[model samples]
Target: MSNNSNTLLGVLAGTAVGATLGILFAPDKGINTRRKLVDEAVATKESLADSALDLRNTVAATVATNKETLDTKIENLVSDASYKADDVINQLEGKLKELKAKNKKLQKS
Candidate 1:
């Protein structure tokens, strides 16, 4: 994702630079050259804005996906812990019953 964004930004920058250089080198009246520059600037600004929006959306989606995955893992871990707790409780109860039986036998004797 980082690589893709970098590539996209690089492409946009290259395009803007190429357009500006081309316009500057072209033979034309002063007024025409200035007008071309303004046009190029506006186009570049719009392109950059659009690229930024796209990058923002991509980042937001990735964050949402990661959050969901983290939530699922947490839930699964809690569920597993609950089951283990139940097993431990059952084992303790069994041990307590055995001790009680031994106590009763000693009292009877």
Candidate 2:
């Protein structure tokens, strides 16, 4: 599972265990104790839900930032490759023209 899910699960498990322990050891009447447990459980659930949402948003933002960075790197690599290729082609064209002129001079002599 994702980190967010695991974290939320841990939070929920901890809340349940703590609430159970508190209820078991409390001196209050059973009805009041039960009500308190229920209220605390609801609040914990809400808190966990909020935390999960925030984690998801953070993950999404991170992913978007990474993707943009990757795209820019790829673009730069492609542009550099194109420039190198053009330079090589121009050099080859110049060499070919020089060879043709030398061949013509030899034939004339």
Name the top lDDT candidate: 1
TM-score of 1: 0.93
Q: What Cα-based lDDT does every candidate model obtain? A: 0.95, 0.88
RMSD of each: 1.1, 2.9
Worst 10 residues of 2 by lDDT: 1-10
lDDT of 1 by residue, 13-73 (tens): 9998998899899999989999998999999899989989999999999999999999999
Instruction: List model 2 lDDT by residue over 39-107, tens digit each.
Output: 888888788788778788988998999999999999999999999999999999999999999999999
Give per-candidate clash totals: 0, 0
